[model samples]
Target: MRETNLDNGVLILSEKIPGVRSAAIGIWIRQGAAHETNADTGASHLLEHMVFKGTRTRSALEIADSLETLGGSLDAYTSREHTSYQARVLDEHIPVALDVLSDLVLSPSLRDSDLSLEREVVLEEIAQVEDTPDDLVFEIHSERLWNGHPYGRSILGTKLSVEGMKGERLRELHSESYVGENLVIAAAGNVEHEEFVDCVASYMDTVVPGVRSEQVAEPSNALAGLELVDRKTAQTHIVFGAEAPPHSSEDRYALILISSVLGGGMSSRLFQKVREDLGLCYSVFTFQSFYRSAGMVGVYIATRPATATRASEAVRGELERIAEQGLSDVDLDRIKQQVKGQVMLSLESTGARLHRLASFALHDEPFQGLDDVLSGIDAVTCEDTLRVAAQYYDPGRHLELRLGPS
Candidate 1:
């Protein structure tokens, strides 16, 4: 892998895979929902959609066909911390991929007519989430857990906010973001580092240098408690979550191990005890999220209303056991191997490597080859899990969220 930061501040990263004929590349802007003000709540996300509407040189229909004609694909998405525009194509089409990606970032035509049409599409997206109990459960939990912090805001802004958005604000957001310092261009596949860098320079040399708006100050108003939302649904959706260490913390490895032991797979304790032993729910899993200043870990479960209380209690029991006893040496070693396997297996695809490369750069993490990552996982000891579990996993510290028919 080779990394370069152009004079304009756009960081370009590329890796060559010897045996593959395909490549994955993307332009990542370090701006998203958290970067927005209340007045322009969904500008970042809305802009993500509008970029595909058209660019100065290409019509919407032409943009759609640009890569598809090459048998490749173009896509983009917005998250809480960042937005990405990406493409996957054969190595020979690398220039086409770069051209389309750079164009979307540099020259979006955010016309009022386009905004009007796309805003409704975004509203429909918001509605879909509200209607899905499981997805809605987490949205409610994040807003409640983080309270008034910017991180708590939904990626899909409310109807009122989206409707109020103007094309002017979106244009300002595009100019404010999508600049050199806030951008990271990355690619992985059968390509040479120098040649890929040259391709990127051709398209992105005109991009201006801009400042990065990273917030390192931790949230002081984080909340935790039981909150219930009444919704008419067949199955109760529950989300139990607690504050966690940020991305830079060494404790992150320990937390991952704890999550895996509890609910990472069918062989996990939650699956064996909750589903197999008690037959409480059809699905149960633990997930982890890390940000620059704040992070969270959660357990999601969907069960019939009659059995909701039992499932909640069962989950709580597992949390208690983990917090108190931590993990045995055998359990720790097994989970470590499990996590290592997952990390090693995912790198076989160019697309996965593309994301890994981009994420490490965005977060200011030093690049870790497979050995470094495997070693990090291997170095975690049983005692380390005990410390993190006790510090972050007190059942009382969690927000107990429930949504379903009453």
Candidate 2:
């Protein structure tokens, strides 16, 4: 792990797992949908789409062809708190990855034609999410849980925002939100540290604004017990959520443990009880969305319309039991081992390592090494899991979202 500061912005580049044939390069920008107001909602995600249309020296096809010709792939995504653009290529094509990333991110044209076309694409995407029950469930959950805050707003914004967004406004947001100060360039696998640093610095140095962002606030909200949507669907999509630790919190590991125990795999409680034993549903699992200022623990289950209520109650019962009785030593040990193994296994891949380094640099300090991560995971004990379980995994705080024939 290596840390460098370029004009007040931090860049963390980690080169682990030597001699790999492939490399992963990523840029993590701190600003996301959460940073937008009512007027500029979805600007972050829209700008993400616009970057692919054209850049300073590369057209959309040029960017695509650059990576495709090298036998590599380029992908990007925007979330509630961050946007990431990444490229995976052969180790020999590392320079090409950097070149394309710099051009798209630093020099996007955000042209009128591109903006107009991309806006339609994004609007269609928003409609797609609305039409899909699985995706729509999470949006409903967010709206019900974070009801009054900017965090509750959709990442794709509204019809009005998408329709009204222009080239100039999108470009302004690109400058304000995707600056060097709020960005981190990270690459892992078969790359030299000095060479990677030089490449990133050369591109980032051309742009000068330093890391300056508004103060982030802690998210606090009362959980709702019931939220239902009557839709013409064959299956019921259920989402349950509650407060959790932010990325920087000490309890973050505990949150991870809770999620793992609940639905990390076939051996997890939700899977074993809901799927293996009662055969209540075909799919049931839990996840943790731990962010910078706040977080949430969510459980999602999709089942036939007939068994939706049963699955919902079973999920609630599992939460209540865990909260009331705490995890057994045997169960806790199993989860700990699984979590540790998962962590170690992920380090083997360059793409996972690159994303991990970038994510940590944005939410916490850039210098948090894998060794530190191992130490933290190792330090977790059954008592630590119990404490976290008691703190944030309360059943009464659980919010439920159901989408189907109600």
Candidate 3:
């Protein structure tokens, strides 16, 4: 892996891999939904859509066709801390991918007509989330978990906020956050670092090195109470969790091991106890959402409304036991192997490597080699898992959100 800084303040990271025929390139911006104000909640996501609508030189169809002709793919997504636009193509087409991606990121048209149409599209997306109970329940849980903070708000924004968005509003937000200093260009697989750097520098050199936005501090508010939304659905979707550490926390590896032990796989305690042994539900799992300053670790379950209470109790019991007794050396060793395998498998993909490069660059984190990561996972002892669980997995700190029939 190599890192370079363009004169314009754009950070470029690349990984050169031999014996591969394809490459993945991406432009990662440090701004995302967390950067929005209450009045413009979904602006980051809306801008992600508007960028592809048109640019100065290419219409939406042209942008789509340009990549399709090369037999490559183009896509983008918005997350809490950042937004990414990436492309995957054969090694020989790396230059084409870089050109198109830079154009979309640096020169979007954001036309009024395009914004109008895309607004409806985004509104429908918001509607789709409303109609999906499982998705909606998680969003509600996040809102309750991070109340009074930007992280609490939905990425899609509310109907009123999306409706009130205008072309100028998006332009203003873009101008403030999408500057050279906040951008990182990353590529991996079947490419030379210097050549890829030159290709990106040609287009990104003109980007003005404007002031980047400030980072969001961790939320200080206490977790709010349980939130129940009546949806009249056949199954109740519940997300129960408590606050955890940030992405950069030393305890992150430990939390990952604990999450997996709790609900990561069929052999996990939640699945084994709730579904296999008790026949409680069809789906039960644990997850973690990590941010720059803070994070959340939780369990998600969808069960028959009649069995929701029992399922919740079962989940609670498992968590309490872990907090008190911690995991056995056997369970710890098993989860470590599971995590190590998952990490090794993910590193085999160029796209995943591209993402990792960009993420490390954006977060200013040093890259950890595969062996190092595996060793870190291996070093986590049973006592460490128990310590994190006891510190961050307290039931009193947990917030629960439920959506189902009245």
Tell me the lDDT of model 2 at 65: 98
| Tens digits of per-residue lDDT for model 2, 305-392 | 8999899889989888877766778876777789889998987888888878777777765456667777787677777777787767
Q: Tens digit of lDDT per residue, candidate 3, span 226-317?
A: 66788889999988978788888889999999999999999899999999999999999999987887888999999998998899889889
What would the TM-scores of all predictions be? 0.98, 0.95, 0.98
Residues 200-314, model 1: lDDT tens digits: 9998888889787676458787777788889999999999999898888888999999999999999999999999999999999999999887789879999999999999999
Assess candidate 2 and give its TM-score to the true structure: 0.95
Per-candidate clashes, comma-separated: 0, 0, 0
Best by lDDT: 1
State the lDDT at 391 in candidate 1: 79
RMSD to true structure for each model, in Å: 1.0, 1.7, 1.1
What lDDT score is found at residue 261 in candidate 3? 90
Pairs that collide in candidate 2 are none
Residue 233 alpha-carbon offset, candidate 3, angstroms: 0.5
Q: Which ten residues in a row have the lowest lDDT in candidate 1?
A: 213-222
Query: Could you tell which candidate, 2 or 3, scores higher by lDDT?
Result: 3
Error of 3 at 104 (Å): 0.4
